[model samples]
Target: MPRMRSSSVIPHLLREQANAVQLYLQYKGYHWNVAGPLFRELHLLFDEHATTVFETIDALAERQRMLGAAAAYTLEDIRLASTIPHERGLPRTTQEMLERLIAAHHVIIEGMHEGFKSAESDQDPGSADLFARFVQAHEKMEWFLRELASEPPPTSEVTGRSSLAREKGVPAAAIPSSHAAPPFAGPPLT
Candidate 1:
């Protein structure tokens, strides 16, 4: 059986797992709905981050089981436990998406920090390490989002292009400079 302190850490871990799930779905939704000059870059970035979050969710739930604890993972449980805000609809712009994600990461990162401290206080090194890793991951993702927010808006070169070009199978970077347009290359945009 796990130590008592380790058991104490399980609920926090479960809450983090729930938040990770929310973050994953939110990232993917933005990946699909994001529009604007930065479409391609943001698209790929969100997808990559979402994949990472999905992995983290799996690992966390498994970790709970490893500790012989019951994992709270149902959608209802996640809805109840997670602090990430509910999204009623897509953000109106790419900037909004970035801001939304940044805000969500802020909450998750804060929670991770608190959870790490709790785990340590509880004398659960394993759980402490897990929370530490999660904090690092969220910090990295937050840095990426914040950096993107600070970047100059996409040049006018990409301003006229439909976000569909990026979504539809054409590489965003390949969409062509004003000097020349390249043929779209990729699987059919479906």
Candidate 2:
């Protein structure tokens, strides 16, 4: 095996660590603010996922230490390194929160793939393994969110027409709807 270079692998670890911190904070926010029919389930799930993500931070930082670099810890350092998008404010609906979480997971998973490749090419099997394991956790969390968001096709109760009718180019008159689709609701106030 080729000798490992900290320069080749530490950047990947730093980015992953930053992402983990951001994701963990986002999960905590959702866990605290989520309110709806599935409140209990979503609340608990968010908290559980947050805890899992939080636990990985230490391992990530320690990996950087083993590679002879100080781990990123300050908010400014994390903010600059993190790729996760910041949430504007509290999500108006639980569904929106799930969507945001799913997107965050996607970002993390994408970064992890790159990190894993870099580590593998640099002959750092330990970091590569770490990336692989963490990406799997993110994937599992995304799966849960996707499953929760899935629902049967949306059909208007009065017209008995599926929502996709419009997209499919079916004549609107053929459906004979008395009601228009609900107007777009804007973001909630802080």
Candidate 3:
């Protein structure tokens, strides 16, 4: 079988590169800003994911270079190429951050699926393999986030009031006030 044309694979590689950079930055933002009850766990998770995403950026860029195309380095170039939606501001809760990260992973996974198909059909095994591996990584990350997002709020052990008491027929006031609100639910940092 004939090898795929460089033109056919380069665009997909470049797009992935841009998405990786954007996702890395978003992860870092959440990592640095996360606070409240689950702050330590969420912060550590975000930073770890950010590092993983950051590692992808170089491989994606090099893949494009191997295809004989110029790797995009300018901020404007990445902004234009990335398909991840722009954020209005920092999320109001850890749940919101988890939701956003899950959605972003979905976008990247979908794009990788398309890119993988294109590369495989074009007989480019290397590019297809890269897409497949990244897809698995993104899927794992998404699953971790989804698990966190799906968890029910903790019940207050002392008073038996759930954090989601208002929705569970218990008086909201009975819930623990200590975990009522996120510590950083304020204006975006300058």
Candidate 4:
């Protein structure tokens, strides 16, 4: 049996586990329902994400057990504690799936941040570390989904601007210049 220190961590752990489970289910739903030109890629990616989330569910539950808290194990427990909204019907388009996933990632990230604060407040470094890991994972997943929905960085416009700038004798280095100074021959400064 794990040693008991405080009760405050239990609620956060329960909520985190529930959220992880709900997100895992949502990813599985997307894996099954995703369709369109990107079907193969999306299908494999969603399945991989679902598996990753399933592993996270186990980790969160085990952490709760380590903290001497009872893990939430039932669908009802997840439904009640999770803020992730489940779709009753499957999304019809790749875009719809991506949008839904982006939303879910944001929800999970917020929950993780809140869990991190709660754990830190309770002085539980282990729990806080777990929550930080959750935050990083969700943020990376969110970036992946966002990339699917994103316009291709307006590549045409960017290339056009650079080409035009070059035509006008602006060096390529100056076209998308950062804070670094331009190369120039000058008298040595003291």
Candidate 5:
């Protein structure tokens, strides 16, 4: 009989499952509570995201069981293991809900990155692949949220000249400057 290798990937998988459960709950909460101009759209989006994350939780838990590790099944276990925070009261606006979703996605991405590192150290290709998929999904979701806040590039009409001038290092004196100081310089002065 082939020797059974002990996999250290279970802990990372369990933690990821816990985080996904927390995220799924938060998404469902926002779906139920979201309001405003985009309520219907946001409600549907949250529900879809929640379902997807919930699916991930199930898969992770099953994988853990397949590896002979016990999966954490209780809410308390999830809460204790999750790095994502459970917001007490959801925000009132659709935009706020979007912002909250973005924050949660960021948290998930961070956790998945850590999970990937752990899985890699354990030589667990399966968990590493799972975490990579998560990173991609979270990044796409973040891009969607960002699109809501995006505006067309400031028109040359507003700047009173083409951006080309600024790009070529034209003197500030030559450019028609707006009263609003260019949003803070690159970094705080040392």
Candidate 6:
């Protein structure tokens, strides 16, 4: 195996570390603040994404340490170096939050591609593998979020509608108006 040149990869590692930190923080923030019709789904998605990003952060920092370079130790360090900007405030809606997440993942995925190439050219197969894994994970997360946001607006001119009810050999209008979550049979209001 060829040796890794720390000089050629440490900066890339540091940038990835910073981006991970930023993404983790952003996911947690969205997880806490998410609301509305898709609140439960978005909240859970954010939490899962936060955990994944936190793991990536640890892996990246460890990579830096293994490379004999100091990893970022503070949000200040991350903020200064990260390409993803911190959220200014809570997003106005779940769609906005999903859009924001997709954007952040885009930045990270682009950086991961860059880092992977650098690592490969530097003859560091381990670092290249790590970058590839993160890229895959980020791509999955981006796809899920984008799918959630891809649904057409309720009022849009959608023709030839196809839905679960239609597939069940029932007309769309024949479907119940409210599938109100099994009447929330958990507990009674005080």
lDDT (CA) for every model shown?
0.78, 0.80, 0.80, 0.73, 0.71, 0.77
In terms of TM-score, the best-performing candidate is: 3
lDDT of 6: 0.77
Best by lDDT: 2
Per residue, candidate 5 scores C-alpha lDDT tens digits across 1-190 of 2112267677777877888888888889888876654567667877887887887887889778777777899889989988776777866555556667788788888878888897898777877888898788778877876665333256444343334334433222223445323554467778
- Give the 10-residue window scoring lowest on summed lDDT in candidate 4: 171-180
How far is each candidate from the true structure, as Cα RMSD in Å?
9.2, 10.8, 10.5, 10.1, 11.0, 10.1
Instruction: Give the per-residue lDDT of model 3 (tens digit) for 22-77.
Output: 99999999999987666777889999999888988998898877767889999999
Give the lowest summed-lDDT range of ten residues in model 1. 165-174
The sequence of per-residue lDDT tens digits that candidate 4 reaches over residues 163-190 is 5433543322233433333445469989
Q: Give the runs in model 4 whose Cα sits over 4 Å from its true position.
A: 1-5, 155-190
Q: Model 1 misses residue 186 by how many Å?
A: 46
The local lDDT score (0 to 100) that residue 92 gets in candidate 4 is: 57
Tell me the deviation in Å of residue 6 in model 2.
4.2
In candidate 6 the C-alpha lDDT for residue 150 amounts to 63
For model 2, state the Cα shift of residue 88 in Å.
1.5
TM-score, predicted candidate 1 vs. hidden true structure? 0.76
Candidate no. 2 TM-score = 0.78
Among all windows of 10 consecutive residues in model 6, the one with the lowest summed lDDT is 153-162
Model 3 spans > 4 angstroms off: 1-6, 152-190
Query: How many steric clashes does model 2 contain?
Result: 0
Show the colliding residue pairs in model 1.
168-189
Off by over 4 Å in 6: 1-6, 153-190
Clashes of each: 1, 0, 0, 0, 0, 0
Instruction: Please state the error at residue 110 of candidate 1 in Å.
Output: 0.6
TM-scores, one per candidate? 0.76, 0.78, 0.79, 0.76, 0.72, 0.78
